[model samples]
Target chain A: MDSIEHQDHPDRELLEMLQEAEAKVEQLRVELDRRREFRRQMRADEAHEGTDEEVERLSEYLEQAQINWQAVRKFFQSAIEEYRADDAWGSGRPGA
Target chain B: MSQTIRDESTDSEHGVRQIEVDGADTAAPASPLRRLPLTGRPLRIVEWLAVVAAIYVMITAVGAIGSGFEAATGGQAEELFSFASNPFVALVIGILATALTQSSSTTTSIVVGMVAGGLPIEIAIPMLMGANVGTTMTSTLVSLGAASDREQFRRAFSAASVHDMFNLLAVAILLPIELIFGVLGTIADWFAQLTTGTDGGIVTTIFTAFGDAVSAVTSPGADLIEAAVMGILPEVIGGVLMILLGIALILLIIKFIANMLKSLLVGRAERIFHAAIGRGPISGIGSGALITVMVQSSSTTTSLTVPMAASGKFSLWQIYPFTVGANIGTTMTAMIAAFGFSGVEGTAAMTAAAVHLIYNLFSATIIFAVPFLRPLPVKGAKWLGDLGAKNKMYVLFWLGGLFIVLPAVLIGVSTWVF
Candidate 1:
């Protein structure tokens, strides 16, 4: 009796197709949510990396403080004028 | 007879030849590139003989000074060198004398002789340290040659000043200990006692034999000179004149020997120096000391490194140990000078010489072994070199401040303020 009844229904196939489409939409929505979360994590990692670079820059600046680079540069400016390149004595100097 | 011959010929090794003109414009052909003279067997023999002669004269001169000093003061020599009794004055004298002569070996050897002639051991000890400090002046001067190029001058000056810094720091540390504890004098005397036989050491026999042989060869000349001077002038005046003559002879002969030896040993020494560089600090120091001993001049040993430093062949740290080694090697001259004396005089002289050796070795051992202390000289030198490279005025100020004004100020303080 039941078999005869089901076989008689005209919209039964269409209803099954609609159910499959809804399941696919839920799967797609979960994937989109994962991608958005991953994007946020990557941005956080980039910000942390930038901080490290800033720390290194500051350390370098501090090291330069120990020696008066301004004075050294100023002196080099004048010294370069008087500096001469003479190989009069080099590696061949006797009494080595 | 000339031992060296000159020739104008092509040298494939150096590709050095006379310049040529394209068309017979013949402006006197440029002087041919000539090679340094090659040494023959006869020349080697002559060189060795000259070396022996120099040593003979040097020892003879030392003896003359000792006897002359004794006679002049009538065995009460305390007052004669009284001004130098203050350790600071003695130190300044050592620095000034060594700087002017450009030879610490000469200064240290003279100090040994003066000690043998009754200069108080306390005074001689500081002078020995000063002589070590003063020897660095030679390399500093050599580095000035590269002053035209900022980088080269910086490197050269740093290399050279590492030596000066190490020595000056050593003095700053040791002199105070030396003053308060007098440890150098005590240790020096102990060794002196070993050679002099007060402690029954077998070295006494060897030391005596060496001294006797030296006396036999050198005494006649010294005696004849003393007798001739004494014959005409009063004993005191003759003594003074003999002392002056002895000093003159020592200065002249030492210069001659240094020049001769430098010419002979330079190539061999250069090879040794190359082999040792970059090996480590120990090898650097060892080769430095060895080359200095071979050529008999610490100045020559240290000056050669200035060029290498400027050329970037080695770092300042690498050359630092070598300079220290030169300091060690130069102590040999004082030891040799000490051997020419015997008895109480011998003991005093030997103690002074030993102090020179001990002070250098001890300072080197302490500074190099300590991780923190090792870089002190290098850092100080780098700072100074950087400053010097920036302005020529700094270099002049350094020369004046460290060598002249500082020592002068110390002398004044030691003499009057104290």
Candidate 2:
């Protein structure tokens, strides 16, 4: 019985990574859009003017969304790098 | 830093992933009663029985406290509250009485009884308003129990104070208007007129009969205790002892009732709240009101939200309308007591009760219905909770100042100045 089920296949791994990254990116984008819309609505509602606490809360939310976006971007970039490396190896290792 | 990831629970079988369900985790041995299956039913039945017992004990305790107050004051509560001719004094009296007893239902019910017994409606009205303010203190005190953990305290305190802030804000807006315009009084008078006909009314008949029955059962014990205490101690001290006993009984009984009810209904409460969230604020308020009416305690209903809020299951906004509903629901006790009166006194009692109901209804409508005003209590409570989280002294100061020191000073000043 083999302990290791399979060897690393960068092409397959990169494909899965791309799917995960795509979902993360979508989620982050939705969250950022939601926060931005909420902040914009708050600004429109002049009744809550001068409430620094609300402002701080919205800022914290925006910061979180930005952090999520950065992580998603990083994941996408790594997925692209893995895909490129796999393509190069596949071309270089030809049957003689 | 590097981290290793593992998915050991998943296994490859025939090139397909297989996941384990662990059926053993869900199975439990059954009892010998195969013909009848009872799961969690017996425990729930016992909890509900305890809940009823706790409520009866609480009612008896409130009766004891009211009787003690009357006995201790030598029926001088009217004289003590005479300075309440100044609405603020009466309001302060209401706050102190409810804070001391820790039940607005008790305080407002007492006010209703007093009004029936010939206490002026004007004085009783302010006291009733004070009860609304004072009752919030119980949940606020309950929230303080979470103070060891700053974050928990912050969330719980905010959840608790939202109720306090709403009531205080309501009083701020309504009390002056009440004093000048007499709008609540007029509305209550109309309600009283509408209900005064038809053989003392169904609500009144039920409440009066309930009140008499409760008194009959509890008064002898209270009187016996009163007589015994007076035999050893001074008359005033004996009265004071009764008051202290009543307060202790109320706190203990309410605590037990809340725990029992929570045990029995938490899952149901969570479901109700979840459903309320989907249905919007009206449904949330209705659930809050309904629960409070069932349990006969707004403090219990509101306090239940603290742990939920602290655990992040609910937000301040979601619980805000529910707490408002608690305010509306709590009026039922006072309203029920009002019906115990007959003739002019009955009219006065019902009037006072109507004032309580109208006050909560008007406050909820005016504050929550107006988009501009809706968020003030929530915002105010959040700020206070944030401040208190940073420094706990603020919590102590709020409890002491609003419930104790301030009420004491106002009452003293009113007595001296008025």
Candidate 3:
């Protein structure tokens, strides 16, 4: 009679385990949101610290740096994209 | 409960897919670097056409001078060169004409033509020697650009003047031997005979073709100019005009070509010189030969090297082989001149040119191959450079005396006494 009762109660334990996992996932999502907001505020503060001329010059330099980085990133990303596209096409599937 | 679980799994998968799509879209745009559709500038076409036009103008100018010479001489071209019968006078004329024109080719071609037209080889040989000496003046003149900077001027002038010293030394050593023993002349004549089956040889054949082509273009205009000027001004006036025009054309061509080359090859040339200097004398000689060949003039090669030397990019030792190589390279003009005449006369003229080439080659072989002879010119040049550094006026005097005053005095005395 005791064995029969243990078998019938298995679904309850499974539900409790799922609830615990969902709670952990929610905590992780909140941490990620805080990190993103902190990064955005730091960037805004940096953008506000200079006199107009100095700010303009800094902005120009930052823009150029950004452009260069973007160019480099684009080059690598495009290469990867090309490889993936080629592989997918070669496999005769839409997103292989 | 199973349905709820399935919905949650699907939602997470959809979120992950959304994030990936967003990341892909945010990955910066493809490289803005595109291959420029236009491979070369349009101005290149204009530059090439300009070069072609300049060449045509140069040929025309040369034609004009030939016509003027024919008109001035009035079929007495042979009589006109009678003064060159004296070897010393011929040598002086060679030096003066080349100095005035600033071109060894012009002087050499004239000498070859004169020789082919019945001027004695003995007379032409001296002229050939004079052309060798006179060619050095171009670099000497080039040194003047650095005159404002005393230290630079001293170095540049010395480098430029060293060529004059070398040529003078060669002439001093070889000329007396040539006059007394006829060693160079004999050897040259023998070689000429072997190659051309006559003293004037194959070079004369080429010169004849050149002369004919020149005559065909210029004779009609020359005849008309002669007819117009014969009564009003002396025939000499027309000749003078021709000479002037020829000179102007040559100067213009040289200036343009030099600027073009400097713009095109100066960076590469600097690198090459730096590398060649480290490789030693053989490399130096090869560099000198190659640069002169590309420039089509040894004076240009030597003159260009002076500035590099002045700037301390090269030492006197490195430059020595270059000068020797230039001496050999310059004789190519005379060979080209030989092609302008035909028959026995052309052969003789070509032989004279060959003599010039052989003389330089032999001198290089003797000086460079043997350790003893190599340092003489270098030592002399350094000594002169030291003197030039102390008294800047010495540069002018050296040029004036060696290329001008001395040659003129020697020729005048020879003419008077002989």
Per-candidate TM vs. native?
0.73, 0.60, 0.59
DockQ for candidate 2: 0.01
Prediction 2 global C-alpha lDDT: 0.66
Give the per-residue lDDT digits (tens) of candidate 1, residues A18-63.
7789999999999999999999778645533333222222212212
**Per-residue alpha-carbon lDDT of model 2 for A10-85, expressed as tens digits?**
4666667788999999999999999999987775444333322221122122112111334334433433453455
Candidate 3 lDDT tens digits, A45-95: 453323222211211221121113343344335334535565321334433
Best-fitting candidate, scored by TM-score: 1
Residue pairs of candidate 1 with colliding backbone atoms: A83-B148, A84-B148
- B324: Cα error in model 2, Å: 1.2
Prediction 2: B-chain TM-score: 0.71
Clashes of 1: 2
Give the docking tier of candidate 3.
Answer: incorrect
> Which lDDT tens digits does candidate 1 get at residues B250-329?
88877677656654454345446545644578887888898888767788777766766776646787678889999998
lDDT of 2 at B294: 61
CAPRI grade of model 2: incorrect
On TM-score, the stronger of 1 and 3 is: 1
Stretches of candidate 2 above 4 Å error? A1-96, B1-80, B198-268, B339-345, B408-418
- i-RMSD of model 2 (Å, 1 decimal): 21.7
**DockQ of candidate 3 against the true complex:** 0.01
After superposition, which runs of candidate 1 have C-alpha atoms over 4 Å from their true positions?
A1-96, B1-39, B198-200
What part of the reference interface contacts, as a 0 to 1 fraction, does candidate 3 reproduce? 0.00
If the candidates were sorted by their TM-score against the true structure, best first, what order would they fall in? 1, 2, 3
